[model samples]
Target: MAEGRSVSDMDVDDVIAMFPKIDPFLIRKWHYAFYTFFDLIGNNVIEWKDFQSLIDAIGAVRGEGSEDHVAAKVSLTKVWKSMTDTMKKDVEDEVKSTSSWKLHVHSSKPCDNRKTEKVLF
Candidate 1:
């Protein structure tokens, strides 16, 4: 060891001792292997274990009280409103055309009246 030089030049232990109040950072998925092989830790990152823990934690939160009901609640009010509109349109069309237009105007209602129906997209 050289005299009058900094501790970083002397040993790895001296360098680690300088910063003793920090948590080791985690890397997500493949980054864990990077940290392990490089003997290094990132400042702030999500490791694979952390992500899995998050997924498990979310599942645990969702499963509270009713473990059998694992259904994710989504707001389908918009979808239902659209369906109601479509149904209303169909009903109005049925009332207007009655079976008389079958011999005359035929398919011109702006809606696809095929039995299979079509997706707008």
Candidate 2:
């Protein structure tokens, strides 16, 4: 890991080296998704506050009390709920570590029968 950075901040090469058994492509995808979406505040961990940032951003653009903003909050809240449900842990009580996130990504199977991995990017 980079100096002063958490394991979540490790580059692709470091991640690949750490989990050599996992596919490199899948590792890259998971890393990309982690940084792009989960680590919204760049803290290297997934927390409710990160999701709140996304909700706040949507509210800023759509107007705080507007329908769109309210809808975004509702939708994101549901997403958070589903994620916590899947993990069987409360996000508000504990942050999701990057290692656990990686495991979750690795364990998930492609939703369809297509040979290609889903293109998240």
Candidate 3:
């Protein structure tokens, strides 16, 4: 498991496995949250950075320390490394491309695209 590797290649099951004590259903819900959040930038996958942030937030809420963070990172990284090279590249490219694109909303009159071409990224 590489420290700098992304976790986008890992599936929902692998990601949820990091939190052994948590309910898998709850983790799936969080995955959906990440999915919806990334949808804003045209990304359907949850990259390692996004998952790490979510994990960090949860750890903070639960008063978790560095040990938990380390363990989560290691678990996720192991899954990430198990992914194929092509999948890894695809995930990396998606993250870079989506993150680079900006969401620009233009509304001149009503809430319609007729007034202005809404470029929602």
Clash pairs, candidate 2, are none
Q: After superposition, how far is residue 28 of candidate 1 from its true place, in Å?
A: 45
What would the per-residue lDDT of candidate 3 be over residues 42-120, giving only the tens digit for each residue? 3454355665675676578765767776676676554333321313344343332221111111112344323222211
How many pairs of residues in model 2 come into backbone collision? 0
Error of 1 at 88 (Å): 0.9
lDDT over C-alpha atoms for residue 56 of model 1: 50
Per-residue error for 105 in candidate 1, Å, reads: 18
In model 3, state the lDDT of residue 108.
Answer: 22
Among these predicted structures, which one has the highest lDDT?
A: 2
Alpha-carbon local distance difference test for all models: 0.29, 0.70, 0.44
TM-scores, all models, native as reference: 0.18, 0.77, 0.33
- Model 3 clash pairs are none
**What is the C-alpha local distance difference test score of candidate 3?**
0.44
Q: Per-residue lDDT of 1-103 in model 2, one digit per residue for the tens?
A: 4446568567778767767788988778777877887689887787788889999998899899789889989977876776665566675744466666666
> Judged by lDDT against the true structure, how good is candidate 1?
0.29
Off by over 4 Å in 2: 1-5, 107-121
